[model samples]
Target: MSLPSVLLRLVASLAFATLASSLSHAQSGEPGCRPEMAGHRLPIQRVQLAKDEVRLTFVGHATFLIETPGGVKIATDYNDYVRPPVTPDIATMNKAHSTHNSRRPDPAIKQVLPGWDPAGKGAAHHDVTLGDVRVRNVPTNIRSYEGGTDYDGNSIFVFEIGDLCIAHLGHLHHPLEPGHLRALGRVDIVLFPVDGSYTLDQEGMLEVLKSLQARVMIPMHFFGGGTLNRFLARTQELWPVERREQPTITLSKAALPTKPTMIVLPGH
Candidate 1:
C-alpha cells in the first residue's frame, strides 16, 4: 500500500476509537449506579468522617441509616414503624408493605425516593445525587397478597459513596435477572432480607447472593435469632458469618474484607 493511503487509514481508525469511547461514556454515565454530581456539594455536618469512609447503622427490620463522608444521611425503607433517630437527608421507601414505606415522610427530608410509581404507569426511575453520594434504584416485582404479582413494586436501592457501592435489597421477592445485575453495576456491600418466607426462599436468596458476590453481606428482616440462625447455618460453609453486638459499623474502600463475609448487626 502507498504511504499516504496507510496514514489515512490509521487516522480513520483512531477517530472511530475515540468516537466509540465517547459514546460509551454518554450512554453509561460515570460509573457505579449513576453519574457523579458536579459543582459545590452540600456542607458536611460531620467532619470526623474521612473522604473514603461510610458509616452504616442497621435500624431494625429492613431499615438502614447510611451516612456518607459528606455527612449526607440516607434512610432505607424509611417507614413509620421503624424510624431512625434523626431526620435523614434522603429517604428511600418501597411499596411492598406499610412497614417498608410511608406516605407522609418527615418534612425535613430533602429527598424522598419511592421504589414504585404511584400512578402505576411504569417502574420508578431515580438517579439522585446529594452531597458526595449518588443514589439509584433497580425496580423489581413483589408478590401481592392476592397471590398475584405486583410488577415494579419493589426496588433495590444502590448507594454510591466514596469508592464503594452499597446495595439495599428492599423486600426482594425473587432472584435478580441478568438485566438487573447489569443495572446494579458493581456492589461492594449488600443489605439483604433473610426471612425465607417473607422475601425469598433460602435457595432463591442464596442464588441472589451468589450472583451479587459482594464483599460484605448484611442480613436484615430476619424477624428473630431463629430465622437468622437458620440462614447462617446454611451459609456458614460458603462464607464467614460474624455476629456483632453493635448495630453500626464504619467501613472504607481500603478496609473491606478480602473475601465475601456476612456480618450480622444487632437490631430488631
Candidate 2:
C-alpha cells in the first residue's frame, strides 16, 4: 500500500522546516533547542506604531527601549540601575561591568540573552525571532580587569525589523575586524558607546563607526555632556549632528536620513 499524495506532501514540508531550523542553529553557533517565541505577542505600547516604524527610547546609560511594530519590546544592555519603565519582552545584557548587565532580571521577560556564556564555555550566540523582530548577536572580546584579553566577553546585538537593521555595540573594547563586518551585513542604524575610555578609544571608535557606514549613528554609554560633546566635536567635520530634545525617536526605513548623521537623544 502507498501513502496518499497529500500526506506525502505534508511530510516533506515538515522535513524542510526541520532542516532549515537546524541550518539556522548551525550558522549561529547556537545548537540544541531554539528560543521559544511564546507569550510575547501582547501589544503593550501606549501608541501603536505603523507597520514600517520602530520606536527607540533612551532609557539611560547603554539601555535603549526598542518597540517594534508587532508590539515586541526589547531592552539593550539591560541593567538594574537603568531600565525601561515597562517590562520588556526581550532583554540583552553584557557582562563587561555591573551596570551593563543585571543579576536579577524581571521575571516577566520572556527572553534574557547574556552576551557572554555563563558556563565558561565559548562565545554566547543567539538568533531569536519573535513577532516580526529578529534578534542576533556577534561575539566580541572585552578587556579584562587584569589587563588581559577576555575573549568573546561582549556581544554586538543586531535587531532586524521593518526593513531596518539596528545594531547595539555592547561594551565594546576594540574595533571590529573583517570577519565581524562580514557577519554584520547592511546596518542601517548603530547605537555605540562614546565614553572613549571604557570602550574603544575615541579614534578607534570613530574608525569603527566609519567602517560600518550606517545611515544613522546614535551615541550611547557616555557618562556626561563633556564626554559626548568631545565626541561630537571630533565628528562635526565628518558627519552632521542632531541633538534631539526628546529621549524617544521613531524611525522607518524609507525615512532615514540621506547621509550619515549623528543623532543624540536627550537622556543620561
Candidate 3:
C-alpha cells in the first residue's frame, strides 16, 4: 500500500515529537514508560574486574554509576532528573547540552569535571585513580553549529580499570581523523551514540566503529524502539549483537569478546 506524501511527513514529525517528548519526561523525572519503550528496567548484575567485583548501575540516558574493582564509585554524565539521582566518587559532564551536563552534582561527589567552558579553555583534562582503577580524559570536538561550535571543547574519556580499557564518546559529531584516532589508541570497549541527529548517524558511527576496532561495542543515546533496532540491524551484519539482560555488564580481562561484538543495554 502506497502511503500519501502528506501522511508520511506527518508520521515522521510525530515520531520525532514522540522521541523529544520521551526525553523530556526522562529529564523531568516523570514516572511511567514512554510509548513503545521496552527494556526500561536494567537487570542488575555483577562482573569481575581483576581481583575485584564491580557493580554497574544505569541511571537512564547516558548516566551510569560504576563501582570500581577496588570499590571506588564513578559516574558519567550524571543527571539528577533521572531516577535514583546518582552520587558517585567521580562524575563527568559534557557541556554540549543540558541533557549531558548538569549545573550541580551530588554534594557527596569527590570530583566533578565539565567537558567545556565559555572561554574555550577546553574540557578540563584530568587523570585520577580510584582504588585500582585509573581514568583519563581527551578533549574532542562536536560538529560546528549555528556558525559556531557547540561543545567543541567536549572530551572523550578513557577508563582503565583492572584489565579493561573503556571509552565513552560524548556526543561525538565528526569521524575520528588520523590524529584523533592516534590519541584514542586502544579501546577494549566503547560507549557510543547511534542516534543520527545529535551525534553521528548510522553510517558515520559505523565508520568510527571500524576505525576504533574495539572488541566490544556498546551503543548509547538511541531514543528507544526502532532507533535502537536500526542501529543493531546496521551493525549486526558486521558484528555479533549480544542482548544483555542488564544495563550494566562487567568484564575482567577474561570474559572479553574475541571477535567484535555489539552489546545493547536497557535505558529508562
Poorest 10 consecutive residues by lDDT, candidate 1? 33-42
Question: 184-227 in candidate 2: lDDT tens per residue?
Answer: 99999999999999899889999999999999999998989999
Q: List ranges where model 3 is wrong by over 4 Å.
A: 1-55, 83-86, 144-147
For model 1, what is the C-alpha lDDT against the true structure?
A: 0.89
Report lDDT (CA) for all predictions: 0.89, 0.90, 0.73
For candidate 1, list the clashing residue pairs, or say none.
Answer: none
Query: In model 2, which runs have C-alpha deviations exceeding 4 angstroms?
Result: 1-45
The alpha-carbon lDDT assigned to residue 118 of candidate 3 equals 51
Cα RMSD for candidates in order: 19.8, 16.1, 14.3
Better of 1 and 3 by TM-score: 1
Per-model TM-score, in order, reads: 0.82, 0.83, 0.77
Error of 3 at 237 (Å): 1.4
Worst 10-residue lDDT window, candidate 3: 35-44
Per-residue lDDT of 74-171 in model 3, one digit per residue for the tens?
A: 77776545433334678777545677876666678787767666566645667887667787787777766675665556778778877678888877
